[model samples]
Target: MKKHEGLNCDDCVEHLYTYLDGELTGETESDVRVHIEGCGDCFGHFEFERTFLRFLEARAKAQCAPEPLRRRIFKEVLLDNGSEAE
Candidate 1:
């Protein structure tokens, strides 16, 4: 395995979406996991990113209103846009 110095926070941030979505394949995922485990700075960055993603997920869930409210908003908001009327 490489010494992990060559990779930095930028690299970690860039790959974070892929890592969370499980898009990384064999060796790349292994390398990222190793770097996160060994490097405190990179690990902190990863933790922050992970927590941010979780917060976004929670916010999205919270923003999802009840079905009647969703329907009312959709009809009042989206249906007001006349572009799709044709």
Candidate 2:
């Protein structure tokens, strides 16, 4: 990818987060991918961001099941209150 024609690092940085989140589509996504693969600096930034995202995801997993349990408890409380209102 040519620096003059393809996305330069400055342009690619704007899309990096969106790219990591799988929010970018089609040509824009393709352009970022190509630029990251070819540019070491951009690739480094991508790696750091990707690793940080993985860390966040790992931390979030611990709380994932608790949200469902909390929701179920709240629903049950609501149902009990509804029965009392009958």
Candidate 3:
């Protein structure tokens, strides 16, 4: 482990999302990277969060509805709105 530097656990928590998202740049980014690598708790939290984010990203991808099914849904909507689907 290297020096703790200016970032404590609290600072690490605050920067967690931004750091993981690759949004942090320059020294701030370097500091958080170093802190996570050096601190066991922070490293574990980073690992868990990164995994969860990957899971969410995988499940959250938009899939287009099939055109026939989409038209059926639109027809239902038009009927409910008192407009005939011609």
TM-score of every candidate: 0.60, 0.71, 0.67
Reference-based lDDT, residue 81, model 1: 60
Give the Å error, residue 16, model 3.
0.6
In model 3, where is the ten-residue run with the lowest total lDDT?
77-86
How large is the C-alpha RMSD of every model relative to the true structure?
6.2, 4.0, 6.2
Off by over 4 Å in 2: 1-4, 64-86
Please give the ranking of all candidate structures by TM-score, highest first, separated by commas.
2, 3, 1
Q: Over the stretch 1-86, how does candidate 3's per-residue lDDT look in tens digits? A: 64545599998889999998999998889998888889999999999999999999888876668899888877777565565434
Ranking by lDDT: 2, 3, 1
**Candidate 1 regions off by >4 Å?**
1-10, 63-86
* Error of model 3, residue 36, in angstroms: 0.6
Q: Which 10 residues in a row give candidate 1 its minimum summed lDDT?
A: 1-10
User: Which clashing pairs does model 2 show?
Assistant: none
Off by over 4 Å in 3: 1-4, 62-86
Model 2, 1-86: lDDT tens digits are 54457788999999989999999998888899999999999999999999999999899887556877888877887777788889
